[model samples]
Target chain A: DAGITQSPRHKVTETGTPVTLRCHQTENHRYMYWYRQDPGHGLRLIHYSYGVKDTDKGEVSDGYSVSRSKTEDFLLTLESATSSQTSVYFCAISGSGDGLGFGYTFGSGTRLTVV
Target chain B: AQSVAQPEDQVNVAEGNPLTVKCTYSVSGNPYLFWYVQYPNRGLQFLLKYITGDNLVKGSYGFEAEFNKSQTSFHLKKPSALVSDSALYFCAVREKDTGRRALTFGSGTRLQVQP
Candidate 1:
């Protein structure tokens, strides 16, 4: 409950369609991230942002993209939806990524399905 | 690269019993470890973290983790397990060696508390 929110708690989309998941944080945190959780696989990082307009890929970033045009919003986009891409996506925010002080606060999560 | 391992897929405990969720990590530098809990249809809640200082780190919801530098493990423990404590638990780590601040997560272990 660190003032984080993820939209479309549940969604179903067809293959090849584009989908976007939004993560909004009330707190003005400096770091935001997108992660996907699937069976047999722990939470894998999809992408992350350190600051406004700053973004980088995670290990599983192949099929996803992220944007941070504003400080409060981090968006994850699936350019062409695939069945394999269906999973529970989570958004996390942190005041400091250095881990010297604070840990990440996560949103409820968005459950996506690609048919 | 830093990595986390949660060997157990599921852990069952009786009410009022002590519970332990094991987590092992690998990192080049001093690791910054963390534990998070996810309830049904809810986001992940930060339980605790270990950056430095005493090996025994206490956190929210009566949870504590011991950072064993020798064994490279940070196991979460609770004196009493509650039915309400049933949920998915995750172990994560961030290494000072990597440029990216995103955490590497384990597969997750489900804690089932029986009444």
Candidate 2:
């Protein structure tokens, strides 16, 4: 409960539609991350932001983009949704050097279904 | 490339018994190891981490892990298992030398505690 909140806890959309997921944190942490969880595959990083406007692609960033215009908010968008993009998305926050000493806190998560 | 492996896909234990989940990692420099738990439809929750210090690190929910440098292993352990402890566990690793502080996670192991 790091004062983190994710919008649209659950959603179902059609293929080719665009969708955006929001992750808001009150801790003001410097690092924000987007990850997707799926059965058998575990959690995979999609994108992350180290600072405002400083974003980078992750292992599974093919269809996802992230934005961090403010310290407290990180947004993840699917430019064009595909059925393969359906999964539970999570936002996590952490500070440099803490290295889990402070531990990374994750939002409740958003379940998206692409039909 | 930094990566982690959870050799076992699943583990079963009875209540009041001890449990162990094996995790091994590979990284260029000293590794930052982490354990996270996910339940049902929720997000990942940090269990513990091993940074720089004693080999044994204690974490939430009475869980602890030992960092074996020679073996490149960080196995999660608990003295007594509880039904509530059943969940999907993931092992993660990051290189200390890399300025890019993103974690590489293992496939995850499901733990089932029998009452």
Candidate 3:
């Protein structure tokens, strides 16, 4: 509802293949985040971008990489897909600072399966 | 480190009955607590947040959460449950001391509202 869209709503790929997911936002927020949701682990942050070309890793960023070359787009890439990497990926954007305190706005989500 | 816990994996409630989903948090400094809901095949949606205010915070879809400092808990509640209320709920926490604004999420709780 916050003008966010995730490409490839659903994707199925074989193991060891590379894959990339895209998140586009029209809100022009200052922060973008990539997260993976799996059973027993709710959701874990993979990476986040506070600005263009400024990215940081999260607790579970080992097999994932992210790029934010533009304000409206953020990309998440899996170098070599594994069965364990199969999960629902979500992209979220939020404003900066503690002013609004509003939570992040999430995209519809991308469901990926590595078979 | 900041962490949140949703003790129950699932909760069942009949239509029109009051419902609650438990959440507890651990943080180094003051905590910023939030609640989110996810429907099948959709991304997480923000429900409410407790930054620094009254203990009771109201959110969307007739949902509210009570923040208890002594207990370090923020439990989500609804006056009456509806079938549409059935979904997965997540609790998140952020620590004031940490400059990293990333949120830590709980394992999630599945709510089932039966008619």
Q: Using lDDT, give the best candidate's number.
A: 3
Runs in model 2 deviating more than 4 A are: A96-99
Chain B: TM-scores of all predictions:
0.96, 0.99, 0.98
Winning model by TM-score: 3
What C-alpha root-mean-square deviation, in Å, does candidate 1 show against the real structure? 1.9
CA lDDT of A68 in candidate 3?
A: 94
How many residue pairs clash (N, CA or C atoms closer than 3 angstroms) in each of the candidate models, in the order given?
0, 0, 0
The residue-by-residue lDDT of candidate 1 on B22-107, one tens digit each, is 99999888888999998887778788899889999999999999999999999999999999999999999998556667899999
Deviation (Å) of A29 in candidate 1: 1.0
C-alpha TM-score for every candidate: 0.95, 0.95, 0.96
**For residues A1-115, what per-residue lDDT tens digits would candidate 1 score against the true structure?**
5588999899999999999999999988999999999977989999999999999999999878888999999999999999999999999888854343556888889999999
Please list all clashing residue pairs in model 2, or write none if there are none: none
Tell me the tens digit of each residue's lDDT in model 3 across B56-97: 999899999999999999999999999999999999998876
- Which tens-of-lDDT digit does each residue in B56-112 have in candidate 2? 999999999999999999999999999999999999988886687788889999999
- The DockQ of predicted model 1 stands at 0.70
Which ranges of candidate 1 are over 4 A from the true structure?
A97-100, B97-99
